[model samples]
Target: MTLTTSGPSSSSAPVAEEDGRRVRRRRHSRYLLAPFVFTVGTAVLFGLFFLWPGVLGLSYSLTDFRGWGDLEFVGLANYLELFQDSEFYQSLGRTFVYAVFSVPVGYVLALAMAVALTSKGARGKTPARIIFFMPWLVSPIIAGVIWRWMFGESFGFVNYIIQLLGGEAVPWASNADLSLFVAVLASAWGGAAFNMLLFIAAISNVPQSYYEAAELDGANGWERFWYITLPSIAPTSVLVILLSSLGSMKEFAMIQALNGGGPGTQNRLVVQYIYETGFERSLVGYAAAASMVLLVILMVIAIIQLRISKRNNAW
Candidate 1:
C-alpha cells in the first residue's frame, strides 16, 4: 500500500514573498523613524525650556508669591498696582527714549560705513572693518565700564579733551539726563558695527549691473545710491532697525554698569527696575507682572515688525 503525505509543501516562492513583505515593512518603519525622533525631540525641548517657563511666569504674575512664601492668588491686583506706579511709567519712558535715539543714529552711521567699506576705491577695508567691529566683541557691560571711565568728570579722557579746549567738565554718568544720553551713545557705538556688517552683505548683493546702467544714464553717485542702493538694501535696513530697536528696548547691562542705575533711578531702564524689585526688594509677584507687561510690549513690537516685513515683501 502507498501512503501520501498530507502536509502542504513549504515552497521557496512563498517563503521569499513573506520575507520581502517583512523587509518592506521594516524599511517603511525606518523611513518614518528619523522624522518621528526629530518631532518628539523638538517638542520636548520647547516644553521643558520655553513653554513651561512662560506658563509658570504668567501664573506667578497673577499671584502674590514672594520668593519663598506661599502663593496668594490676587487676580490682576499686581497689574493694577503696576499701572498706578509712577516709577514704572518713568522707566518705560526712559526705555522708549533710549530706543528712539539709538536705533536711527546707529542705522545711519552703519549704512554710511558699509557704503564706504564696500566701495572699490576703498583702502584698508579689512582693518577698518575689524576696528569698527571690535567694540561689539567686548561685552556690553564691559564696554559700559570703559566708557564710564572715559566720561569721568575728573581725570577722564573726554573731560581732559574738553578742558584742553577751555570747556568745562561735564558729568556724563552722574546727572540723570546726561546719563541717559551717555547710555544711548555707548549703545549706538557697539550697535553700529553689527548693523554695518549686515548692510555690507546686503549692499554687496545688489547687482553691479544696476549701478552700471544708472551710471550710463548719467546718474551721479548720490543719485545711484538714492535710487538703487537704498531700494536694494531696504529689507536689510528693516532688519537692522528691528534688531537695534529690540536691543535698545531691553538695554540693561550697559545702564547697570555705566551708573548702576543710580543717581536716584534716573538712569534706570524698566528691566533694571524689574530686577531691583524682584531680587533686591523681594517683590516677586509685582516684578513678574512688570516682566509680563514688558513681554507683551515686545510681542506687539515683533508682530508689528513682522507685518511690516510681510507688507514690504522683505521676508
Candidate 2:
C-alpha cells in the first residue's frame, strides 16, 4: 500500500509541474502581446504616412505629374532638367553657404552660452538662461519679421543707429551678401538657445572630480574646460553640429519671410526653390526630383555625423 501511494504521488508531482509550465507559457504570451500590438500599429502608421508618400514622391520624380491631371512618364527628364537648371544650382550653392556659416556660428555661440551659464561664479544663471532661451520659443516667422524690421535697408533701426554714429547706412536688404549674412546671424541666434540647453545637460553630467583634479594640478578655467569638459561632451557637440547643419540646410520659412528670397532671388535656398518650382510654378515632378536630391544630401550628412559620433564614443 505504501509503494502504491508513493507512485501516485510522483505521477501527481509531474502533472503539477506540467500545469505550472503551461501557466507560465500563457503568462509570457500575455506579456508579449502589448509590445507586439504597439509595434504593428507603429509599422502600419509609418507605412501609411511616410513610406507611401516617399514611394509616391519617387514615382512622381520619374514622371511629369503637375500636382493634378494625368501622370506622364518622362523617364528621368525631371532629374536631367534639375541637373541643368541654373536656378537650382544657385539655390543649392546658397544653401550650402548658409549651412556652413550658420552651423558653426550657432555651435560656438551655444557652447559659449552653456559654459557661461554653468560657470561656478556665474550670476543670475536662471534669468540669463531664460533670456537666452526665449529666442528659441519665438516663431520663426515672427523672428524673421523682427529682424527684417531692424535690418531694413531704408529707415531701419540699424541704419538709424548707423546714421547717428556718423556711419553710412548698410544695405541689408538690397545686397545679397548682406542679406545672407543677416539670415545666418538670425539662424544662429534662434538656434543657439536649444543647443545651449543640450550643452547644459551634457555639461552637468560631467563628473565634478575631473575639474577638481585639474584645478589641483594648477589648471586654469580655460585649460580645464579645454582638456576635460570639451572631451567629455564630444558626443553632445557632434549631435548639436549635426542638428544645426541639417536645420540650416533645410531652412525656408524664416528666410522667406525675412527677405522673400529677395535681392532678386539671390539668397533663395534649395527649399525655397523647390517650393516655388512645385507649388508656385506647378512643376511638381521637377520639384520632386530636387527634393530627392536634397534628401540624399541630408542622408549623407547624417550618416557621416553618426559615424563620427560612433568613433567618438569608441574613443
Highest TM-score scorer: 2
Error of 1 at 112 (Å): 1.9
Which residue pairs in model 1 clash with each other? none
| Number of the predicted model whose lDDT against the real structure is largest | 2
Q: Which lDDT values do the candidates have, in the order given?
A: 0.89, 0.94
Candidate 1 local Cα displacement, residue 162, angstroms: 1.3
Tens digit of lDDT per residue, candidate 1, span 1-315? 999765445566788899999999999999899899999999999999999988888999999988997999999999999999999998899889878888888889899999999998999998999999998898988998988888877867999999999999997756888877777788888779989999999999999999999999999999999999998998898889888888888888888888887678876899999999999999888999999999899889988997888888844
lDDT of 2 by residue, 1-315 (tens): 355345678779989999999999999999999899999999999999999998888999999988899999999899988999999999999999999999999999999999999998999999999999999999999989999999998878999999999999999999999999999999999999999999999999999999999999999998999999999999899999999989999999899889989899999999999999999999999899999999999999999999988987887
Deviation in Å, model 2, residue 257 alpha carbon: 0.6
| Residue 283 local lDDT, model 2 | 91
Q: lDDT of candidate 1?
A: 0.89
Error of 1 at 137 (Å): 1.2
Worst 10 residues of 1 by lDDT: 4-13
Query: Could you tell me the lDDT of residue 78 within candidate 1?
Result: 97
Candidate 2 TM-score, true structure as reference: 0.89
Q: Can you give the TM-score per candidate against the true fold?
A: 0.86, 0.89
